[model samples]
Target: MNSAKSPAKKSWLQTLIKNKNERKKVIFIFTISFLLVVAGLIYIPIYKHSLPLDSKIYEGNFKELGSIARIGFFAALAIYPIFLLLKWKPLSHIKKGNFELKPLIQFLAKYVRQWHVPIALISTAMIILHGYMALIKGFQANFTYFSGIITMAVLACLLVMGVKRYKRTDKKWHLKFAISFLVLFMIHATFS
Candidate 1:
């Protein structure tokens, strides 16, 4: 009976792993759990050392720099989705049917594709600067900061996947990571 149950359990596990959607669900669940654990670990220390709400660090230009960085980041983030919209099936049909708009849509698509990587890199730099300034200000124990940290981590993974995609070492992972990063960033931004 024990041996028979072991084989059944093993086959069940194998089936779960063999299914692509199931594998993705498992990975997503594990990733969220790991991030939560990491967040908890980091949050405690940061919360302990966090400054009072009214405490001002140096009255330097951090705020201005952060604002600029955010704008730059959003500009970069918008490129890919805009490019997607340009290449959407409905839009493609319109482009095919409407000769006048074809040139405009094609031009926009090409331009956006050309700028995607460069803008992403620039935005990454801006995010780094923004995060550094935020750290200098103080790490308050809040959902906003936690979400930002998670977004940053996802962005790092997205960057790696982007490089892999560029090098032809990967195919779909970059897009998946990009979508994940976008969702996480939106949450972070909205909360903040």
Candidate 2:
């Protein structure tokens, strides 16, 4: 009886892997797990006093420059997701034979796509500067710092995926990374 159940269990697992929605759920689970592990790695050292913190370094205009960088980062980060919404939402409508807004959606999507790469590049630079300003003031083991590091790592992956997508060397990973980055960035921003 145990042997008879073995193939059935294996087939069930295989079927789950083959299903698109199930596959997505599995991928999401794995992604979240990986991110949690990363956060733990970052948080544990600071929690244990292995990491040094010097609050004195926060002097000077670092705060002001960090604020400016934050503003620039937000501005650039805001645009790309609009493009994704514009590009994607219309497709579902179109599938249902609703073409009333097709032309307008396409036009907006095209315009947004044109600006996406440039804005992303600018945002990357702003984030780098922002990170430098913060770290120069010493590392603080807080939600904001932890989230920021994870968000930055996600953004780096997003940038690489974006470049590969642009060069036609890949397609789907860029969107995945973009969504991940957006979610992580939101968390980071909220804590800040």
Best candidate, TM-score-wise?
1
TM-scores for all predictions = 0.58, 0.52
lDDT tens readout by residue for model 1, 1-192: 455544444454455356455445545555654564456446534764563433454223444544565665566566666766766777645634437554676787676655565556655655665565566567888887788788889888887887676456667788788778767776777667
Model 2: per-residue Cα lDDT at residue 71: 60
Candidate with best lDDT: 1
lDDT by residue for model 2 (1-192), tens: 355544444454355355455455545545654564456446544553533334434433444544554565555455565656665754546544555556666676665555455445554554665575577556899998888888888888887776576446656787778678767776776667
**Cα lDDT computed for each candidate against the true fold:** 0.63, 0.60
List the candidate 1 regions with Cα displacement exceeding 4 Å. Answer: 1-67, 77-99
Please state the error at residue 141 of candidate 1 in Å. 2.0
Question: Total backbone clashes of model 1?
Answer: 0
lDDT of 2 at 72: 51
